[model samples]
Target: MAAELRLLLLLVCWTALASSRCEFPAIFNFGDSNSDTGGLSASFGEAVPPNGESFFHGPAGRFCDGRLVIDFIAQHSGLPYLNAYLDSVGSNFSHGANFATAGSTILRQNTTLFQSGFSPFSLDVQSWQFNQFKTRGGVAYGKGGVYRELLPKQQVFSKALYTFDIGQNDLTSGLFRNLSIDEVKAYIPDALAQFSDVVKGIYDQGGRSFWIHNTGPFGCLAYVLERLPVLASQIDQAGCATPFNELAQFFNEKLNQTVVRLRKHFPHAVFTYVDVYSVKYELISQAKKNGFGNPLRACCGHGGKYNYNMNLGCGGKKKVAGRQVLVGSSCADPWRYVNWDGVHYTQAGNKFVFDHIVDGKFSDPPRPLRLACHKHI
Candidate 1:
């Protein structure tokens, strides 16, 4: 009877492991505004209303009107929405934490192009924060010495997904500073070096599953189209700036090459290079078929061909023609527009992109969303 009881206990343990829906116990994300849950708001107290009006109904510190792709990813992966690392009160770090910040660059140094100011917490800084979190077991320990076992086992860190969506700011900042595309391309090696160091640092900390997204098509963004010089002939059939799109393609090429090298360096690591550029460009190229009404215009902001006014920006009140007026206002339907407030995507746009990329075809190893948890297991 005792032997039978021991056999039953073994079966129960096997069943629990087999029935587990998600492969990884947690997901630790690193990026810029593209996936910043609340790091920017916690740091600077910005990202107020109209910013998260769609689903959240209030500013959740995400750059979108509603949810980010990362939020959708968390939901799809059977994990809770990742909380910002800086959020101290009532945050459940068991699912994982987001270390992304708005306006974050890959390199620690401030870019001279476009007067892009220094980010207090860049990717390097975020990686450092991750190291600190790993050392402390979780953010709760750092807060008050309350040793909560967020990452209980050292093996849990190896099983967690380490995702990234950065480096756009590095390229955009150079472009904004009036640096030529050639000059911007020259910075790729240095940016990739920094990115490599971050990945290596995480690897050293025992992170093995990586999902790194390449930068999207920046040329198609309303902000870039408004600021950069574009000839009428240079515009594509989809109304995107072709020259800028080419630049983005070039950057992706280089990034893919770097990913190949990283794969060689970390042979045992599951490094999925997410093709964000292709997925986003397809949405713009086929907007009419994809249920989008305005692919090139922004849902908010004022005074430009693309409805993106640099002076007004997004969610800000500005004096236009000597009168104080709201410069940015929500459109009647944000779902119909691809670009939101010039730079970021509308919630609908983000969902569309997420749906396409989550299938694993966009990933290097082709690990589907449902299998992401089991890929390394």
Candidate 2:
């Protein structure tokens, strides 16, 4: 009788693992800079100095001091490091691909920096990728290949987890250009709705489970405060603009609601909200409450006071008047800091966020909607 009971327990555990929606064959990512690996470098631009100096010690094409959160999560989930979609050299989508670009938005109007070619992760690009995977035959191998690869080795990502980290750049651009807070607020719900539609598009193309990361605390980011005068007077020390943060919270709340609604629309789909807003809030609050000093300060920055620039990047030298001058500065310790510059996070900072996601702290496990996204294999 004891042996029979033990057999029953094993069967129950196996059943639970099989039922989770995340049990996909592999992961495919979409969204913007927060998850971008090398998308920005694919485009022509003035090279920023302080980008990617921490772990790789050079511009490895990331906007951070080291690996971004997506890289870490992929590693933690026991998958190969996600390759940038444009990385012709080593990206193998036999598992999946990342089409996220730096500074991409769901809506074309939300584009911030690269205004000339301002194409949000428009349906066009997503469709293009889908088509490419179905044809290109090289690194851009077709979806048929992915399907074949997975059928045999489905266990690798039997519960494939997707990660989307975008939207900050969109909001940042409007706020920096002196747009009214109310104007930005008005656009957010529409953005969330558009973003939700994009996710659903992916689902229609064979995606099973998804983890949608809400936007971070844009108000607390140092760049926003420095760029917006009104924010300086209101909540400058916090490094985030108060109105922006509130807008972010508002958007996230609505985003969660949208995710809830999506669950009803697609009952078989497992949608999870990665609450980056709260995770970031905790990091900054802890930094401030402990007087960490330089909470708002970036670990790598050029210039002083109001005019910080990343153009000079860390450890670079510039020549002026026949003499060389250091173009940028790096913090004494990157692990202790959060903001990499006015735009990104340190490796340590991302690790902290990862801890929260895997453990399900400060919120319920499997998210409130509770779809079968991350079941054990």
Q: Whose lDDT is greatest here?
A: 1
lDDT of 2 by residue, 299-365 (tens): 7777756325645544557898999876666777888887777667778778777777654433322
Expressed as tens digits, the lDDT of each residue in 1-377 for candidate 1 is 99667555644543455555447778899998889999888877768668899998988888778899999988887888898998765677777889998888887754532355445678899999989888876444555443554443456788888889988878877887789889989988898888899999999999887888998888888878888878999988888888888887887788788888988898888777889898999999899999998788889877678888877777878677999777688798999988888888999999998999886667765555555544332
Model 2 lDDT at residue 161: 56
Model 2 worst lDDT window (10 residues)? 361-370
- Backbone atom clashes (below 3 Å) for every candidate: 3, 18
The number of the candidate with the highest TM-score is: 1
RMSD of each: 8.1, 6.7
How much is 202 displaced in model 2, in angstroms? 0.9
